[model samples]
Target: MQLAAIREARAAKVAEARRILATAETEKRSLNPAEQSAFDKFKAEITSLEADEQRATFMEDCERRALGDPVGDRSFSAVQRQVNVVEVIRAQMEGRSLSGAAAEFAQETERRTGRKAQGVFVPLSAIESRAVNTTSTAPELVPTIHRADQYIEPFRNSLLARRLGVRVLSGLSGNLSIPKHGTGTTVGWVAENAALPTGDMSFDGVTLAPKHAGGITEQSRQLIMQSSPDIEQLVRDDLSFMLAQAIDSALIKGGGTNEPVGVLSTSGIQTASLATLSWQNVLAMLQKLDIVNASAANIVASTKAKAKLAGTLKAAGIAGYILEGGKVGDLPAYFSNQVAEKTGTPNTGRVIAGDWSQVMLGIWSEVDILVNPYAEGAYSKGNVLIRAMATVDAAVRHPEAFVVADDLAI
Candidate 1:
């Protein structure tokens, strides 16, 4: 499957190269600077296709080994692993010869793929007093991109489900397929030559494709420039916090249209209807994890639900609060505003209980910063607009590991 995509992508580059040649042929002139650069890029990408094919082969080898299928050559580890993707990409965009670690990466990649390095370029922006942060997409006068080095966001705890030990896969690319095993081989007593039952584990898959998610920040020149010495950190913190909030919100209740499927929307997950945030309901939700065989678990609920549980009695005649000391049913409980207070009838909140480790978060890219230094309006007014983004997806390894209730009353 991945090979087909690679071939298609390679063919596209080849066609692009052909188109460049064909255009020059029709124009009856030598290739222009932009045309030549594009042609070279396409050529480089074509060579890299072979590496992608090898990568697919390596993945297929692992799958075959796991499924006990007939396996072939296992020599798919290329030297590209030593390369720093960000540095190489940045160097390529700057049109400068790579040095140090980047140069070594280029040689290794080119040698392994038998072609010069090239790829789909993603703009890497930096924090600085530059015109790139103008108000518009295109800058005012001169067209130039932005830059930054080792930019970092302010330190803070991420309230996302990841803190609950969810499995996080980072720096991934292309389409991914995660194999799921269900019900291993069964054993049954066989009586004196009687036929035995045949049973084997059923298999399924959780697929993750690249999806784009990002936000834009528009800043006045004065604020980014003269307002503070650490404007960069402030901007970064804002972007990081917003991005993290969006991801966390999606983890709880994404609709799966342009974003990833989340806990409430994942198919086959356990569900229950609760009209009140009571001890019985919380216990019922916890019991849903019986089949999960989890060593520990956690509960995430809406703020209102937390409030109600914190004030409600454990039982009809119980003395203590149902939720005491930030714990519910002896399990730690957390409340988030992202838990969707406007769900179901009466616009109630949501509550989830599960072995959080079964949650899988796939990150295709980190916080990608893009800046347009030349927006006419921003340049003239001394303003800048910053865009921060990341591509990610979420899935559940075992739907049964989670129980969700949207009927929780505040």
Candidate 2:
């Protein structure tokens, strides 16, 4: 019988035994010979059912172990018995899922967490033992593995997105606006006692709404099954880099349709026109900024523009513009290929100088991922497509804090 069926039968037998015992108690007498025989039969059936149940449970546990998975409770001991940590880590490094039992460990973790699972499931004692062994000999693998830091550039290092001031939001979407204080009535100064004129504070609303940014990555089933574990991380990093750059681009040069209004598009920001990038031009843009904004400003330009600026600095022998250690003076300089390299008839490059703090970036907390097994191209290659998407928005709180040096020689 199935486990459920067996359990149900055992329950019925237990109930019968209880009924027999209760009847004798109600009569306030020992069971008669016939009643005693009936009681004994019920007891025998319940005992047999209990043994069957135990055997079923044992069989289930054995199957779970064979599958390299933990049973219902997901306890530590159960995990330890079913997973091989070393094999799991090796599988990850190769950009492939572990076959056989090791794969089960990943599956179980993903089932519980509803996210991609990485790493192993070894006990602390086992890790300590491994550490001890590794300490005596040259470590089998270095403690750290280095990869290109692509994702960090746009969001982690971008002037507008990271260094500049921004208010972070957790929700998927919402409205945001800045308040404007009303001017108090300018009453002429009176000797000591006239009641101060009253004025009302007015608010202006700047609606903040998030737009979607996302991309899809497709890999062959054969590659997933045969490749090394680093492939997974590679895909993850690439997706993140793609989204980060997109959002960063929108923040700098977006047309303000579906995307955020970029710094270049904001009204009333200071501007400088220069035919070529020069130290004096950069300094002029800096000077045009409000003193408050200049205190915390950063410079952002395209790689081409940075190269041009560096050349000009070298020609002029301006050591200050050399950008040693990635900075020029007190301002940190960043390069983004996304910034427009040329615009208008003269084909001018652009440089943005601003206090990033005046820009606000809002994002939904989690990136939504969907795995598709039957996408059009995926079907032919026996592969799957993993698409990641996020919702975000950006707004400038004060345009006066920014200056754009456009019409620069490219």
Candidate 3:
């Protein structure tokens, strides 16, 4: 009876094992032929377990080994051995999806950063012709049209060397010609049309072979091999630095912190109770401030009350404006066009405006404001505010006074 009971248990275990095998088989059908064979072999080994006790022991051993437990003995039962077992199968499945997303993000970042170096060749259209030999029957030299493509290789090499942090060794190509006085011997030719910018020398392919003497490591070489993104980034950085320098130079050249030299006076307000200030009086004040340019005066008026006070001060030969209060958005337009019109400056001018308290708290506060002791009430309590700080010139000279003259508030 004990033997019979064991037989029944074994039969039940075999049925359970068959169900697992069927599932694995279904999975195998989705795989290619080679993978299906692997699955079939594993299935066959599992199916060979003859007793329920043996099958349970085998499965438990497999679970332990799959969980990274040591399998000290190799001669264990086939069912107990962990073969083709996957740990973190879910993570492996998700990894494939993540790889695609990562690639797209990297590409977009590169684009936004403007990390792409481009090269173009400007070909020489004409060259001085050599005199024809009267004694020999020779054809006239055909001038080749130079295309920018010829320079691409050297530019790419320079870019690659920069990315790899390797020193570049470049040489110019010599002109290709045989010496007229030499004894019938042919001299080697030189490249004639290579003109690279300063810090980038033209490379002559015929006369000089490209070579690196030292400092090339395995890692650097690998970097150069995949240097496209690095080259692009270098170009982007170079352009930004150049632009910043240009802006700074423009600002300094316009006038280094000099107040706009122009006049300021109010007009057109006359009443017994109110202090009288007229538009004509304001214009006269602007004129007294030495604002001779009409365009400068017009822009200040155009900007109205939002005209940048600092720009106006700069125009009037003052150290710039002290911003007590004003709208921020109008400041740029007010100053930009006026600076361009009056000073012949290009592009938008920069302005920094702040409230009374913030200006006092700022690190560069002293550069922007001044206190007036005589004014009354809120006007007397005004704080010197830096309305605009630009790396470029302001639009209008005495723009603030001009705005006042034009009955504009800015």
Q: Pick the candidate with the highest TM-score.
A: 1
Candidate 3 lDDT by residue in tens digits, 217-248: 01111211222433323322222232222222
Candidate 2 whole-model C-alpha lDDT, 0 to 1: 0.57
Q: Which stretches of candidate 2 lie over 4 Å from their true place?
A: 1-160, 163-166, 178-201, 225-229, 276-280, 291-294, 313-325
Q: Which should have the higher TM-score, number 2 or number 3? A: 2
lDDT of 2 at 16: 57
| lDDT (0 to 1) per candidate | 0.62, 0.57, 0.25
Candidate 3 has a TM-score of 0.16
With candidate 2 superimposed using the best TM-score fit, by how many Å does residue 325's alpha carbon deviate from the native? 4.9
Q: TM-score of predicted model 1?
A: 0.61
- Which TM-score value belongs to model 2? 0.55
Return whichever of 1 and 3 wins on TM-score. 1
What TM-score goes with each of the models? 0.61, 0.55, 0.16
* For every candidate, C-alpha RMSD to the true structure in Å: 19.9, 25.8, 39.1
Clashes of each: 13, 15, 42
Summarize candidate 2's per-residue lDDT along 11-65 as a digit string, tens digits: 6566556555655764578888987888899888878888888888778667667
